[model samples]
Target chain A: MGEIVFQKPKSLCDVPLHYCPGCTHGIVHRLVAEAIDELGIEGQTIGVASVGCSVFTLLRA
Target chain B: MADKVLMKGNEAIAEAAIMAGCRFYFGYPITPQTEVAAYMAKRMPKIGGTFLQAESEIAAINMCIGVASTGKRVMTSSSSPGISLKEEGISYMAGCDLPALIVNVERGGPGLGGIQPSQSDYFQATRGGGHGDYHLFVVAPASVQEMVSLTAHAFNVAEKYRVPAMLLADGTLGQMMEPVSIEGITVEDHDKSWALTGTDCKRKHNIINSLSLLPEELEQWNLERYKRYEKIEAEEPMWEEYMMDDADVCVVAFGIASRVSRNAIKAARAQGIKVGMIRPITLWPFPKKPLLAAADKVKSFVTVELNMGQMVEDVELATRCKRPILMANRVGGCIPTPEQVLAQIVEANKLGGAQ
Candidate 1:
């Protein structure tokens, strides 16, 4: 491997995602994060995580 | 707005709720809607929000009620069976005029229905799932994209009307993956004037409850709530119409069923059958205006549902049967295919043409 690059989407927080393979949770997570980033409310915004497979990934928001 | 991402309906709802300023989430693990709870659990803590997985559906909804009482934006989600368990709390939330988002990723029926998509909850959702003469702001999303937008809209409607709002999605819509572009909203810019966060000189302590011993007082409360509903009916009705112009027949459906019906309409039209679709975005309001308008042009109407015929009754009430109305549906976690709906439309057209 030439190089390992890690770039996080501005919409997503620096948190590990726990969704299963082929899961849409990551996509939705990015959309929400992007919406927050576009709206420029990253600091003031708060999120509520649910209890399904995505529960462990809440820290990313 | 350009980049599109594929997502499930349940996950989309969680994303939309967060973007809509939902700071509190309380829910139990339930099939078809477990992703919503899981999404919240992982995200709430990092954002300084609260997410609690209650022991049961009842505990979940009541926890929602408690958080909502504090004037914090809150939400909960479940599938058919779990939603059934949360009915009492839902009714109480309505009685208290509390604003909160409740998503029901609907599955099959009267009991512990399977984890497949179904619209059997039409009566339960639109007729007030719990006991009482009250109604909720019920929105049915047909796609994963609509799921995100509608979930955000649900929060706005609930806050504006001071009522509980529900996103009624079926298993197909909940589980299907689709591209969605989230755009044009700021979570922090929402108005918090009506929140109950310990009044500071601008207002008195807000008491949110649903108990009134006096019959007269309760009656007055009901009347007031009805007035609010009337205002909503006049201002907040939402729906979508496809190919109604010069069509001889119309199919009325919502959620996943309506999506199939849309494809059915296209197929029928390709076969020289004049068919159209009327999809109600707001199920409680029932899109009476457009349905009544379509009734005038179409000779017959076909009501498609995942359940027996719950919304068909509303269709009949709206159209007043000036034209014949037929029902086509599936039950017990079954979903009617486009071919089934197309056949119904063809039969309706044949009958109308014969007459």
Candidate 2:
């Protein structure tokens, strides 16, 4: 059996998320983190948690 | 981010707005700034923001006004003709004291003149573009980087002062590509106490209209708005002085023309000429104090611009005609080369520039 290794994006924090099951916000958040990782500009980004459900995504990140 | 990335001025404005927590954008497409709309169109949805391409520039600005009244960050961008079309809503925004970012990637002419880079909209922008005595806090970004910083800064200023602020850039600055750092000083989450978030029985209903039709009441609102404008002028005069420490000739310019003049100053200085520059980062505040001080020291002034000397009048007012203020400008979409400005500098020097 091949060993499984997990690597998280540097732009995303390692924390448990509270998004609803099968919510698209999770995918959106991961893609945002992935883009930030790809650009290698995580430190320069300012994440704005709007007054909505995505505010939790900001918190989880 | 501290890391610099190459970006067009228009796209930088869009990205910077996102960094500034602007989730609402309403604009119509017009060159040389449609990239702002395009960028927002792509990014806003991903961030759960609204990016609406309205029917016309008129509809776009009204949509911005609607979003701004709700106390969320919103913006709109247009070129010369499109901005002229949206003047009514701009005035309404000013009258209502709504916080919104209005960007004018300016081009030439009194009408739908030319699409090439020009600074012909200085008067329309600085003066009331819309009717009434209301003022827009006009900011000019000479480079792609400034298009980001000043666009972000416009949101802060607008929210703080509860007024509409304009990011005034010409076509050259809009289309030009340069490296910009998109890190710190971008997103600022200001308290939206004045926004019309639902009362929920906790506070009074917030009124967000500019229609105080009674003569006495409307006059009072005008007076109050004037007071705020005065405060802005007093507090927000921003500029950059280059080589003015010992410069004999002080060159006045802004936006793309200032960049050209900067190169001219550098080249002329290598030839032992004393030419300097004063670039106003904030067009509304106009940086009169330092300009007056430079005018006191320098013998004469050379105003370089893409238009036929609209800003020279403001410089004249600042200097009070104490020195000879000459202009080297181009119109109908032609930007004068550095050589042309260098020649103008040599002429101004010979004509008692820094004596």
Among these predicted structures, which one has the highest TM-score?
2
Model 1, native contacts kept: 0.00
Candidate 2 clash figure, as a count: 3
* Docking category of candidate 1: incorrect
DockQ of each: 0.01, 0.01
Candidate 1 lDDT score at position A55: 47
Where model 2 places Cα greater than 4 Å from the true spot, the runs are A1-61, B186-191, B353-355
After best superposition, candidate 2 residue B182: deviation in angstroms? Answer: 0.6
lDDT of 1 at B234: 90
- Candidate 1 residue lDDT tens string, B78-195: 9999989999999999998888888999888778868887888889999998989899999999988889888888888888888899999988888889998776544444455655
Give per-residue CA lDDT, model 2, range B1-355, as digits (tens): 3889999999999999999889999989998999999999999999999999999999999888778878888999999999999999999899889989999998888789989989888988889688999778899998888888888899999887888999999888888899998866655567777776665535544556666437998899999988888899999989999999998999999989998999899999999998899998888878899998987788889999888889999999998888898899999899989999999999888776332
Give the chain B TM-score achieved by candidate 2.
0.97
